[model samples]
Target: MADVTHASNAPPAHLAAGTPPILELVNIAKYFPGVIANENVSLNVFPGEIHALLGENGAGKSTLMNVVTGLYQPDAGEIIIDGYGTTFPAPDAAIAAGIGMVHQHFRLVPRFTVAENLHLGWSETPRRLSGKDIEERASALSKKFGLPITPSAVVSSLSAGEQQRVEILRVLSRGARLLILDEPTAVLSPVEVGELFSALRRFRSEGGAVVIISHKLDEIMALADRVSVLRQGRLVGTHQTCDVTPDSLVTEMIGRPVTLATSYPRQSPAPAGGEAEPLSLKQVTVRDAAGVVRLDDVSLALRPGEVLGIAGVTGNGQPELAEVLTGLKAAESGTVYLNGKAANRADPAMFAHAGVGHVPEDRLKRALMPGLSVAENMALREYDRPPIGGRFSFSMAQARKFAQMLADRAGVKLPGTQVQIRGLSGGNQQRLVLEREIRIASHVLVASYPSRGLDIGAISAMRDMLARARDAGVAVVLMSEDLDEIFALSDRIAVLYAGRLMGVMDRADADRESIGALMSGRNLSEAA
Candidate 1:
């Protein structure tokens, strides 16, 4: 039990402020074909406040936001903006009402510069501002928001954090007074997250209201003035953040008390040199299609029963490392050894034959067949291996049974394996990937950003699965942009920056400040 003081049924304190709420939802209800997505949900957001919408996946947070942003029309209830009762039939109408949304996946043109991206979809005025004027205006907005982004930088060439800034700036440039951000910190490094928080605070100070949807308890506690919890499409409670604890929020969100400790084995790691390394890379260098070095002289060894966590910002060579390990890309130089066999020239098929399992970052594109049935997708890696199927024929019954067994072991709750894989929630999809990869990976497992979009419960379950694999003597490479994840799961943490390995250190030696400094481009020794 938690010692949290439950929120009152009355309207939030912000409603009592001198000004009218910037945005208000009154008895909002929405429905899908066979489900109620939101039921009688009401919220009040004041100017200069950050209101956090907390919920588990499928808990109706996104649905509620979609309704507010005019992506969906609620079956019941109404919206009020700046004390005016209104309805938005489309996103442009929502924008006209001074409401804007930044979705989890950004909507930026890849080849366009920041200024050009900002100019997109705009009805050019008769004044006809030059490119220089657009860049200057965008640059001023970036500095004003404390994002410090280059207005002339190409969207494709920018880091994840910078691209996120562009998204935020786009909304602000449209004269939005109320901003809605979904999972804003999902892809950011700690430093970038700090910058984002600063920007949010500045926005609030400038009388802009924000509604942020996130599952990160620490972030909600740190940044939000008030939090509203939802479960199963119903508003559970709305409380001042100062009055709640993380445990209380988790309980309200998931209907359970969760243990926060790492589930990985607590035993001392096996000596790196004493065992035959199952996966070893030595001075591996890789180049992109454009002839730019993506990975530079990186080297590491993964011992059986150990998890080597690679931590860095996105576009810092993590993708190249994953590609090299999974045989999706050949290294330009150096050696890759899998189960003590050289895999330098190996393609994905060769790596699969060598017992390498990969759970790619983008599950839909690289790992799972979205249109395929769950059972069929689950058996993708092992269909031709044995009794489940032969070289030419696969037993549907056997495949379903195998998938069910693995799903049960992985704690994946799916309605049926015959359903399309695309219908599963983010957490369940990742669970299916974990189930298949852990079962098929005999030599080594490589999981990139495995828990990126998952809620706390799903993250815990995924960590438990990885720990089980480690306990069963499988070598694991866990690459993530989240430092907390690295600290939780890795026996040793490897830092990557500018496509090079900064340093590798035991978990005991890894500290937030030092790792953050390394991630910000400080030399490892100097950071230490």
Candidate 2:
């Protein structure tokens, strides 16, 4: 790889002009049992700046941020605020020092009112304020930041974007001068994202410092003033956003030149020849344990040798839809047809037997057993069959051999198949899951967020794998939050909003604007 570490060791240019950083870390280091999460990583956040932290998964961005936020005491480092060196004993201490972090998952109590949540951990309150007083304070902060919210509304009743606003306001309410946001836009709609960026710009214009961690290069380019890249727990470099291109950043992040697979050439599915569709849903309706309708009257079909991309924001019934298709969750009404035969009540094993493979959204919880060895985990869906094992017999040797073959084919990097699956990188683990599922999927495959957290290289490879599966006469249902991925991979696009099917259309007839409008609950005509 070409060296892109031009200013790896230089301090921000403002320092030479006698401006002190709002927050700074010098020679920070952190360690796990056998992993060095960070090593000699130094960075600075100046007032009125939006600094972006860029790294592939496991590149120490989280570890470094945790040290700054007082989640973990660094093994070695000096933290400076303004000009004074300080140590934070806990998150509260960090907050007291004008530092606050908004994690990807909001930390608000669902059942509590927005006002109550804002006051829950406020130590600066000299006296117990009444409910109305708290709401009044929250309302003032909301207006000050241009973030609208109903302080009396329960947190659970708010939308994802609304909940996020509450999180940001809570930090500002606590007098946070330097704010840190982790993957803040991952689950937001485009409109919400724009709203968030506008708010961040406003915060910066008021002389507040912000650090945002994200993998979306376009977002980084558009929002960040300066970008710092981390690789293998070391600082690759920090450069003004104007000085580097997106490709250079990717090269710095993964330490290699990468050709990102943005889109594939359109290909028509093979003729059905009077055969039934591989998978189809007929007015499927699903309700959760609480009697809430998770999937409402959804109907769709998947044809062999084609990719059907299901696009939606998070929490719009994507999970319930994927579960119903794979027979993991039964629908309250309507039917799931596998090759034209109703299979609504079929269990996972029965679906698997019918050649329906699923790569679940929650990889560890639903797909792989972390404690098991790689080979063992790979054998999960085939343990009772030949080669892997028999009904009353087992074959470790065959299992390892099968696993090694699949791992090599999938380009999964691992020490050996005997190592625990949890010990591998996220990309490798996802590859293992894909290999197992694809091998078993002769008719249909359902993959949910297959490349959600992987690095660029892994994402490229994953897209290739899914495309290959589709080309090999297997029907593929791809459930994804990324609009780019959906546009790049889908032959047909389906939009879901609040558990209802907004519409389905050919990829040729779809664009980000239309899909995005549907995702926000607009009908097809309105979206058009």
Q: Per-residue lDDT for 181 in model 2?
A: 95
Estimate candidate 2's RMSD in Å.
4.5
**All candidates' lDDT scores?**
0.84, 0.86
lDDT of candidate model 2 versus the reference: 0.86
Off by over 4 Å in 2: 1-16, 125-133, 265-276, 286-296, 312-317, 346-355, 360-442, 497-528
User: Best candidate per lDDT, number?
Assistant: 2
The residue-by-residue lDDT of candidate 1 on 149-187, one tens digit each, is 788889998877889999998888778889999989888
Q: Residues 1-528, candidate 2, lDDT per residue (tens digit)?
A: 123444533334443555668888899998876677899888788888889998877688877888999998999989999889999989989999999999865789999999889888688654878889989988888998888899999998887788999999999988899999987886676788999999999998898999998888889999988899999888878898888899999999988888766687635556565666988999999998789999999989888888999998788899899899888998899989988888878498888988999998768768999899999999999999998889799899999999999899988755678888876666778888998999889999999988866778778989999998888889899999888899999989999899999999899999889998998899988987
Give the Cα error of residue 323 in candidate 1, in Å. 1.6
